[model samples]
Target: RRQFLITRIYAPKAWWFGFCSSVYSIAGLWAGAALAIYAAMIEHKNVAVF
Candidate 1:
């Protein structure tokens, strides 16, 4: 009974980790895209000012 309860508790934690991993990956992708766009905008602005 003790082992069963421990397993049940960890099962949800395992699922939570999986869900968090996907969310983290998606956020990382968006951050990368935003950085790229910002860099392009800076380059364009410099060109226009020069």
Candidate 2:
């Protein structure tokens, strides 16, 4: 019974870690995409000015 209790707690912690990591990865991807778009827009404006 003691071991089962420990296992139950550990399982949820592991699941939470997996969920958090996935969210982190998705956020990173979104930030990277936004940065790229902003950079492209700036370059476009610079080209037009030249």
Candidate 3:
């Protein structure tokens, strides 16, 4: 049927879009955490030196 064909075409696109967005969000969170930890470490070192 025409509806079935249309659903098949769009389903994968929707799934792929969701998958990519989730991956991007996860990577962004990881990068943010890493930057926070690095900044804290640098601050700690500076405090100890002074």
Candidate number with the higher lDDT (1 or 2)? 2
Candidate 1 vs candidate 3: the lDDT winner is 3
Worst 10 residues of 1 by lDDT: 41-50
**Segments in model 2 whose C-alpha atoms lie over 4 Å from true places:** 1-10, 44-50
User: lDDT tens string, model 1, 1-50?
Assistant: 99867866879887678789999999999999997788787987665433
How do all models score by TM-score? Answer: 0.63, 0.66, 0.66
Task: Write down the worst ten-residue block by lDDT for model 3.
Answer: 41-50
Q: Write the per-residue lDDT of candidate 3 for residues 3-47, one digit (tens) a residue.
A: 867876879887678789999999999999997888777987665
Q: lDDT at 8 for candidate 2? A: 66
**Model 1, C-alpha of 5: deviation from truth (Å):** 17
True-structure lDDT of candidate 1 = 0.81
